[model samples]
Target: MDAVEHFVKFYKKLDNQSLTELALLYSDNIVFVDPVRKHQGLPAMRHYFAQLLQNVSTCTFDILQVDKADPTVTVTWVMHFNHPKLKSGKTVSVDGISQLVITNNKISYQRDYYDLGSMLYEHIPLIGSFIRYLKGRLAT
Candidate 1:
């Protein structure tokens, strides 16, 4: 498969929410970094995904651009979901950039740069309060 094909296949696996398919794209010791947390290895990646599935029911990724020649690729993504635990019920739309490093057709590293507050914590009830408190603290 070509670079774009591999990238799209990765997202296709995500859309299916197939753990087996998703796992195929990554190296055993994949490294993931984002605004909220840094995760290393497949086990850590599974933990991170478990948290995501706990809250989100449906999500779709949109691709904006591709630099096929380079092993590193960047994608624009917007995830849509509802969290049952947040404020009784709250839905969120999150926009972010997913930067991935692919080698030999498998992803070795993936870094997501997105706002945690907007993507998740803010809509939460008690957690939202705590996040707001932290925001206030940072503002000062």
Candidate 2:
């Protein structure tokens, strides 16, 4: 399968246990970036994913669209996740997109764009209220 197809399939089935299979879709010197942090190399990527999923009760991605041009592919998706500390374990959905560069049949570079406030801070307790209020104030 093509790299984009492989990525979609792998992510749909990804979890803490399946983290070891990251090598199947990423290069050894992969560079991954998100709104929160940046990581280089497969080991760092594995660690980041592990930590990110450690406390997650459940996490899944709903693919919305895919645009490809040779080695570059842009995937727009909505991530739905549940965490005990966030929103009282209620499911949270965040819209995001991933830009991936395929090299040697593996992903060598990946950058994710998403709102950190919506994904995290907005789900917090006191912080949620404060942030929401601040947003409303700015909108008015």
Candidate 3:
């Protein structure tokens, strides 16, 4: 399979709890970037996914748009994660665009663009309160 198919397969495997399939999706020196962090190498990527996947009950991706130019593919999708710890204890949809760079039939780099405000800021009661308080303090 080509790099794009490999990456999509990895995401599908994730949703199915087939974590072992993730082993082949990334290059040893892969670079992954997202709203919260930037990680280099497969080890870091694996660690990040391990925690992230385990935190949710179920997750699914709905593609809104996709554009591909040579080795770079950009995809806009809504990823819904249902987790008990979420403030609503319900499905929360986080929408984002991901840019994937395919090299030699493997994903060499990936960057996820998502809003912190939409994914997290307003989700927490105390943290949301703190952010509001800080916003109010600065606005005056």
Candidate 4:
């Protein structure tokens, strides 16, 4: 399969165990950026994923669409994860998009866009309530 296809397949079944396969999908000099933080190089990416998934009970991705243009690809997906600290360990779904730049048949750059409030802040008790109230107020 191609790099983009490989990426989609890898992420669809991503978990702590599958993290070892990151090298197959990303270049050694990969630069990854997300709403949370930035990671440079494949090693850094591995460490980041390790911490991100270590406490998660489950994590999955539903790929919605893919837009490709030569060396660049954009994918839209919904991430479903259960975290002990979020939503009482229940599943939380968050919509997100990832843009990747492929070079030498490996992903050299990737940046993810998603709402922090939807993925984290809104899951906190007091923060959730306040955010909901603000959303409600803004909607009216």
Per lDDT, the best of the predicted structures is 4
Q: Which ten residues in a row have the lowest lDDT in candidate 3?
A: 9-18
Candidate 3 residue runs with Cα over 4 Å from true position: 126-140
Backbone clash pairs in model 2 (N, Cα, C under 3 Å; residues 3+ apart or in different chains), count:
0
TM-score, one value per model: 0.74, 0.94, 0.83, 0.96
TM-score-based ranking, best first? 4, 2, 3, 1
TM-score, predicted candidate 2 vs. hidden true structure: 0.94
Query: Candidate 1: what lDDT?
Result: 0.72
On residues 1-140, what C-alpha lDDT tens digit does candidate 4 reach at each position? 88999999988887635777898999999999998889999989989889878878888899999999989999999999999998999999999999999999999999999999999989999999999899899999
Off by over 4 Å in 2: none
Model 1, runs deviating above 4 Å: 2-6, 9-15, 87-90, 125-140
- Each prediction's whole-model lDDT (CA): 0.72, 0.90, 0.78, 0.92
Question: Model 1, 1-140: lDDT tens per residue?
Answer: 75456666566345357565556767788899998778998888888776776656554566556554478887777766666665455557778788888877677888988787877678766888898898999999
Instruction: Supply candidate 1's per-residue lDDT for 26.
Output: 79
Give stretches of model 4 more than 4 Å off.
none
lDDT of 2 by residue, 1-140 (tens): 87888888877755534887788889999999999889999999989988878879888888889999978999999888999999999999999999999999999999999999999999888999999999999999
